[model samples]
Target: MKVLVTGAAGSIGRVVTVGLAELGHVVVGLDRVPQPDGEDSAWHTVDATDADAVAAVFEEESPDAVVHLAGHPGEASLPDSLTSHVVTTGALLDAMVEHDVRRLVYASSNHAVGRTPRGGPPEAGPVGADARLRPDTFYGVAKVAAEALMSLYADRYGIDAVACRIGSFLERPETVRHLATWLSPDDCVRMVAAALTAPAPGFAVLYGISHNTRAWWDLAPGRALGYEPRDDAEDFAGIIEARPEDEAEAAHVGGPYATAQFERPALDRTS
Candidate 1:
């Protein structure tokens, strides 16, 4: 399968692009910046926000699927968040519609349910993928909105869309909270590959995390889609630094994103 990955120069994108290629899928990369040195995937210098540029890439590459990892990766004002997440998604979906691309594997975030109180193991079962949205910040809200768009497109157009609400994607578990939330680089690739090849998953949401013993989110949804994550964050638990704020961060599924530090005015009035 020929796959197009946006944000190809990013941390996760870089991993996914190379990983997919290693899995024998023809990989094509798209990003606003120039492709990094030593990388061999077919590269396109185009911002995802520009519908025309995205469309042009779709027409030229004619990919079988897309792994959308574009847009701002951090908190922003509401409008900026919408543009970075929603608008960019809209452009890709529109391009997919035009180009007849059938599959999309989105890089959604755990913050889409950031405000949900942590409950799993002793207290209750892990949070299911069908849990209601409790977005922690503008960034989370944008993710929810983008997901709604994917659902709409899936239903109306018969496009197979899979939204993976990724947890803390890191090289290794660095903190106590990460013990339950870390998504290993290898697992991230596995998740995307499964989402890409799952047979006719019309519209699905799956938590993106490794097979961690301390996981707070259910992996059943991902497993249903053939995403069998292998890494377990608990393997590195002994090396993780436990900080005083770990309890507070673990209070909600979104960690510190649900806290006051991310609370900002809806609009940037000064700008």
Candidate 2:
């Protein structure tokens, strides 16, 4: 299948592009970042916030699947950050619609439900897919809006939308919170690939997290997507020390990222 990965130069987008190619799909890398003169990527330079430009690429490529990863990422500085991110995501959806393209694997975030309490005790059963969208920050708000767009495009336009509410994707499973939420690079590849190829994923919001002992994000709806996450953080528990009790307290909470420096967040959301 032909695939288009917007924001292909970004951390996660790069991986997704390469991963799809390795899986034998023809992949095109789209980004505002200028491509090298003789690049291997079927690269295109376009602003995601400009629907006209984005649509032109989609129309030209006519990709069977689109992994919408491009956006002006949110920052904690209130309204300015929100404007950039919210506007960019809107452009992404409008363009996708204009082309009559379906099968979109949206790159959403755990922050969409980050404010929900993370239970210390295991719930009787896993969390449901119908959980509320209670975001903790402007960043999370943008994700919620984007996820809503996916729903609208799928239900109203007869498209297939898989909003992967991705958890943390780290280079190494270090922090205690990461042990529960870590989505390794390989697992990231698997989740996105599953969402793209799923026969029928009509308007679904599924968590993109690996199997770990402390995981709180629900994965029940992801079964239809065929996402069998293979990595586990437990194997590295002994090598990484936990954060101090106070820091761990905040980080282990569902709002762990609430403590994150919004002005210059250290965490890599793109991953």
Candidate 3:
């Protein structure tokens, strides 16, 4: 299968692109950042928000699947962030429709349900795709809107959309919260590959996390996509200091991003 990976130079993108190529899929990597030579994938520089540019790529590549990961990755002030996420996502969806590309693996975030309380009853288990939207920041809100766009396209255009509510995707667990939330790079590729190959995913929202013992998110939805995560954060659980249950970060599913103040510094606005 031929695959187009947007934001293909980012941390997760790099892993996914290489993993897809190793699996024998032709991978075309698109990003504003130019990739170094000798990579397994073919790279192209394109700002995602540009509809015409994105359409041209779609027209040219005509890929069998797309893993949409390009966006303003972190929480930021209005316009620029919105353009990077929502606007760019809209452009991609439109281009997908125009080019008749049916399969999409959207990079949604756990922050889409950021306000949910963590550590519920042990038997209750973690939240699933049916979890309510509780965006904790503008960035999360943008993901919410993009998810809606995916739904619209899937319903009206027969697009097979898989929205992955990804947790803290990192190479390693950095903080205490990450023990439950961290999604290893290998697991990230596994999940994306599942999304790409799933038989009939019309429109589904699924969690993207590893098989962590203390995971606060469910894996059942991901299983439907053929994802079987192998890495577990608990392997390094003894090394990282655990935060007390009473800490604010331990209380919400969003972690520190849930409570961060978003006021823009004066110097930042001048840029």
Candidate 4:
């Protein structure tokens, strides 16, 4: 299958693009910036938020699937983050729909349901696809909105949209929280591959994390989509030091993002 990967120059995008190519899929890379030399794939420089630009690329590439990963990663000014996350995603979806691209693997975040209490009783279990939205930040709220948009497109336009509630995607586990939330690069690739190939995945949400024994998010939904993660953050347990977290941090799934505040004057709050 020919796949188009937005944010193809990003850390995860770079890896996924290569991974897809290795699997014999033709990858069309799209990003605001060009990838470094040695990336043997078709690439395009386009701003994802620009509807015309995205549509033009979709019309030209005519990809069979899209891995939508382009957006502002959180911790920035509120407006920039929201616009990038929501607008870019909206444009991408519209373009995909217009071009009859059937499969979409969205890079949603665990933060979309970040306010949920963690470390509960074993019966309580980890957060699943059925969990309600409790976004911890503006960035997370944008992801929640994007998920809804995907749902709409899938139900009304017959797009097979898979919202991947990705956990902390890091090169390695850096802290205790990471042990349970880390999404290894290989597992991330595996998850996307499964989502792309899964049969009749009309509209679904799947957790994107590794097979960590300490994982607090359930992987059953991902498995149902044909993803079987092989890596575990515990492999770095002996090498990485676990840091102590406060009660507030320990209470919620999003940790610091659940409590972050971008300081602003009262008069500038609306701005």
Tens digits of per-residue lDDT, candidate 3, 150-252, equal 9999999999999999998988897788888989999998999999999989999888989999888899999978999999999988888756632777678
Q: Give the lowest summed-lDDT range of ten residues in model 3.
A: 262-271
lDDT of predicted model 4: 0.87
Give the Cα lDDT of each candidate.
0.94, 0.75, 0.86, 0.87
**If ranked by TM-score, best first, what sequence of candidates would result?**
1, 4, 3, 2
Model 3: colliding residue pairs? none
Pairs of residues clashing in candidate 4: none
**Tens digit per residue, CA lDDT, model 2, 1-271:** 9988887888788788888899999999888898645559688898777778878888888888788787654445445445455566666667667876777887888878776665445644445568777776777877887777677767788888888887877766877777777888898999999999888778888888887776667666776679988788887788877556435334423445555443354343656
Provide TM-scores for the models.
0.98, 0.87, 0.93, 0.94
Give the clash count for model 4: 0
User: In candidate 1, residue 114 scores what lDDT?
Assistant: 94
Candidate 3 residue runs with Cα over 4 Å from true position: 243-246, 262-271
Which pairs clash in the backbone of model 1?
none
Minimal lDDT window, size 10, model 2: 246-255
User: Model 4, range 154-195, lDDT digits (tens) per residue?
Assistant: 999999999999999999988777888899999999999999
User: Which ten-residue region of model 4 has the weakest summed lDDT?
Assistant: 262-271
What ordering of candidates by lDDT runs from best to worst?
Answer: 1, 4, 3, 2
Error of 1 at 161 (Å): 0.1
Candidate 2 RMSD to the correct structure: 4.7
